[model samples]
Target: MDRIAFDIAHLLAGGLVLVSFMMIYQDRLYALLNVFALHAVLLSLSVSWQAYTQHAPHLYVTAAIALIFKAIVIPGVLHRIIRQMGIHREVEKVVGVGVTMLAGMGLVAMSIVLMLGLTEAADAFAREDLAFALSVVLLGLLMMVTRRNAVSQVVGFMSLENGLILAATGAKGMPLVVEISVAFSVLIAFIVIGVFLFRIRERFDTVDDVALEDYRGEVE
Candidate 1:
């Protein structure tokens, strides 16, 4: 409840939202991966700050998981995947960048207004974190929907999970079991996506999901 603690939490949460916008703005696959790595690093710092402020040792574990797995392992795997798949071109988008940016701004505005109105009695830091986390989640979803490439969509999904972690650590009494589950879930999802990437590339010879639309079989 200290003013300084509130300010720091707000700043970190706001950085997550800002990075979500950066992801939406990135066109190149490698650039988007770099931004996603930044996103994970911010999430780790935010969680560590939460641990320090809340005096929760378990959240530090969460922060380490974010730093180690998300920031280091996942991005490395993704870079390798891109290299192996020869998908070094600019990411194709289903919509224009300007329109997507407008939509992302609108999502942020909606999340702030909605979370603020709904959590009036919550702690100031929690209220701000929830608002920003919601914005990150929305922007991540927007990225997934707007990008035609599978790997970029995977990055969006990971970004969305980072928002969920921010929300969990911001609020009180999240079980370590749940945090572990979430981390493992992301790993499992990455594995599944990696397998699918290879399979899709083998069959379609491309990871751009848009191309699959033309090959869809007609319903009998």
Candidate 2:
């Protein structure tokens, strides 16, 4: 039973990393949002599995927050915002898909090597989960840096937070308060970024970060 539980948890954590890769490759805003929603769904499942295997019930609240907010509400809101802004069909890419994917693979390899070296004494489950979490976080950063749209950057940031949540749940005896704080922080970030998106649109008539950079006299 222990081995089975570990395998399931490992698989779910790996799924999150896979979804993060998918997010990096998406050039279209709508497709990216959809993939992020899928990412959040995978995270919720991963957290719920952790809760079950560790017998940590408070993790369920964390899972529920991921499902309701990240999976559903955030995506729905972002979709509507894109539609209203008339940017649903737009595609933005600062780097080629091939290059981004290769870089992501390198980051994953590095994460695995680093985690394995640093966590030699940790449990196998935690070592794998932390490695995957780091991969997801790095991929999210790559996604943010390679995208020109504000919405896509927001998606990247949220995906990065998903990785943090995954790592937290993987650790044994993480407090409920810490999980709740993380969730609230993400919610606040979403709200702030949503408003910021609107403001950018209002001023520049678009949500392209490169354009905003130019407007601010910043090198792009």
Candidate 3:
């Protein structure tokens, strides 16, 4: 039963990572936010399951934070921001969706290889969990770089942080860093992102970073 719980948690975490990749392909503002909310839900479930399987109640607090902050509050704020900003149209994509997905896959492969080497001779469960976490992190970075939209970049960074939380939970004897830091980091990020989004809207009437490039004082 423990193994079954572990496998279920693994599946949930992997699903969240896959959803993170999908966020890269989204071109609609509302849909992108919805996808992020779904990803958060998956993250909460995964962490809760990890807490259950490992008998680590500390992780349950992490899961609650994810569910409340990421899944509910963040999305609520973003939705209001979008509605008030009048950015209901489709978002701007710097690259074709297919290319972004391919890059995401490459990142996943690289993460797996690096994790396999770094966690060599480690426990089997730790090895696999860390690999997935790294993949989610790298793919999140890929999304941030490839997508030229402010909201999507925020989503990407959140996904990266989610991966870090996952890795922290998987590591043996890990402390409260995941539980505590996530709240602090997310709170800070939300405030910064809120200000940035408002500025983006004020500058271009939209949150598309590509459009904001026109205001860059540097000529290249």
Best by lDDT: 1
Q: What is the lDDT of candidate 1?
A: 0.81
Q: Candidate 2's error at 72, in angstroms?
A: 0.4
lDDT of 2 by residue, 1-220 (tens): 3888888888999999999998877767788889989999999999899888788888888888889888998888778777776663555777789999999999999999999887468877788889999999899898878776667777888899889888888878777635564666577466646655655342223446675677678874
**Per-residue lDDT value at 122 in model 2:** 84
Which regions of candidate 2 are displaced past 4 Å? 176-193, 202-220
- Which digits, one per residue and each the tens of the lDDT, describe model 1 over residues 1-220? 6889888888899999999999998988899989989999999999989889888888888788888878888788777777777764588888899999999999999999999897458867678789998999999999888886777877888899889888888887667635563666578466647655555432232445565556665323
Candidate 3 lDDT over residue span 159-199, tens digit each: 88888888877876688756565776667466647655556
Ranking by TM-score: 1, 2, 3
Candidate 2 vs candidate 3, TM-score winner: 2
Query: Which residue pairs clash in candidate 3?
Result: none
The regions of model 1 sitting more than 4 angstroms off are: 176-189, 202-216
User: What TM-score quantifies how close candidate 2 is to the native fold?
Assistant: 0.86
Error of 1 at 100 (Å): 0.2
* lDDT values for all models: 0.81, 0.81, 0.77
